[model samples]
Target: MALRMNVQARLDHRFAATYNRFMAAAERRWAYESRGQLLSGLTGRVLEVGAGTGVNIPHYKNADHVVLVEPWPAMRSQLHQKVARDARVATTVVDAVVEDLPFPGASFDAVVCTFVLCSVEDSYAALAEIQRVLRPGGTLAFLEHVRGGWLASRVQDLLTPVIRRFAAGCHPNRDTEGDIERAGFTVLQSETLKPLPVVPWFAPFVKGAASPADHP
Candidate 1:
């Protein structure tokens, strides 16, 4: 299916600082808690999509080999710091986005995605690509922000225009979990809960393995 998410090139050179600060502030509070849960669930030959600055570094305990994707050039400086001199997550970075993923099909045992679908140009397609590349029964774990209650949903809809402009394509209200379902995976377990501070809406997530593969 052709997706409408590639609306424009929102990843430009101008909003780098704004994105950096926004993410740095987001990390300490609610995000840290949510991300901690997601990372702990990851295991075995994990492939992390959109691993910005390797923020998921410390939580990468289950992995002996971890591959990450981060295409943005602007975030690389901060990302390097997260890479660290001896980080726990032994990381190899992929300089590309989801749609143009560089790995072969059925190449991963697991995939990690956190707070990433909203900014993706075509998140549904990206999920399909993830499902395509992962071995059947491979785990797909995510912690993302998406459309929620009617009140916050309305606010997210209204703010999306301006939010996308200033926040380097971050969207407050994309129905990310819905798209994951459509991509041919069964959600093994999920939870919907709110993060702290002023951030509105619930953080709905799915951490599950897919269907069994057809063997020849």
Candidate 2:
């Protein structure tokens, strides 16, 4: 079991190192636009969880300061490189997981998550942390691929085991929207889309903003 865990960690490291290259085509096709829309108008101190390779860095136009949280070493290395190259936004990279964020309560003005909640060990725990760190009336912006139609959902379920091993723990059929709502966030605006025509199983993408139900 220990040996198997080590091998899985090694595979995850490799996936982190090459994640940007694997998603480059998809980013150009539709992800960039979707990310820009999700992050638009966000300002003040912002926190982005699971900021893989800093793909959303260039789209941040109004943020005063950005904190990027990535737990994986290889992914953080690439994220640091991206931050170094981009001077448009003031940014800091922190090594932390979503479930256990090392920050004070109500520390950030806005929190962002892009393709993150799907892969977390505990989605509810992660969301709780996100809510704890966000100030009153603060926004939570997200872009996630979620469970789709009947056939697509079955395909996601069948492939998740293999995909989770090699794709850095991604579960393509998560009901992330429902998870967010259940975590006390009131959906402000949301849109669902089938971004990848070739990848039917990757459909039903959800992008939107929400605020804490009690605060809002």
Candidate 3:
């Protein structure tokens, strides 16, 4: 079990090193635009959970300060390099996971999550933490690839085991949108899109904003 854990950690670190390169084409095609749309107009203190490699850094134009959280050491290394070069927004990098955000309740006015929910050890718990840290009436802006259609979902299910091993814990078959609703966030605006045409299993991405149901 120790050996297995070590191997998995190495795999995760390798994935982190190449993550940005792997997603560059997808970012150019649609991800950048989607991020801009979802993250635009954000203000006050903002927290971005599972902020892999800081891809959303440039899009945070209107935010007063941005706190980025990434669990993997390699990913945080890359994220730090990007944050160092970016002067648009005041930023801080934290080594943490979404399911266990180390902060006080109602601390942030907005929370951003992109391409993260599908991989968390417990999506519901992560969402609960996200809700806990958000101020009343705070927004949760997210963009994620979720479970696809019947056939695609089945394919995703079949591939998930292998995919998770190599893709840094990503589960392609997760019903993330439904999970969000079940987590008590009222969907304000959502759109389903096919961002990566070549990756059929990664189709049907969901981008949207939500607020805590109790707050609204």
Tell me the TM-score of each prediction against the true structure. Answer: 0.82, 0.96, 0.96
Give me candidate 1's TM-score against the actual structure. 0.82
Worst 10 residues of 1 by lDDT: 207-216
Tell me the tens digit of each residue's lDDT in model 3 across 96-207: 8888889999999999989999889799999999999999999999899999899899999999999999999898999998999999999899999875364866768999
In model 3, which runs have C-alpha deviations exceeding 4 angstroms? Answer: 196-198
Query: For candidate 2, lDDT tens digit of each residue in 147-206?
Result: 878898999999888888998898888889999999999999999877656585566899
Candidate 3 — worst ten consecutive residues by lDDT sum?
194-203
Q: Could you tell me the lDDT of residue 111 within candidate 3?
A: 96
The list of candidate 1 runs beyond 4 A from truth reads 1-15, 18-20, 201-216
Query: Which residue pairs clash within candidate 2?
Result: none
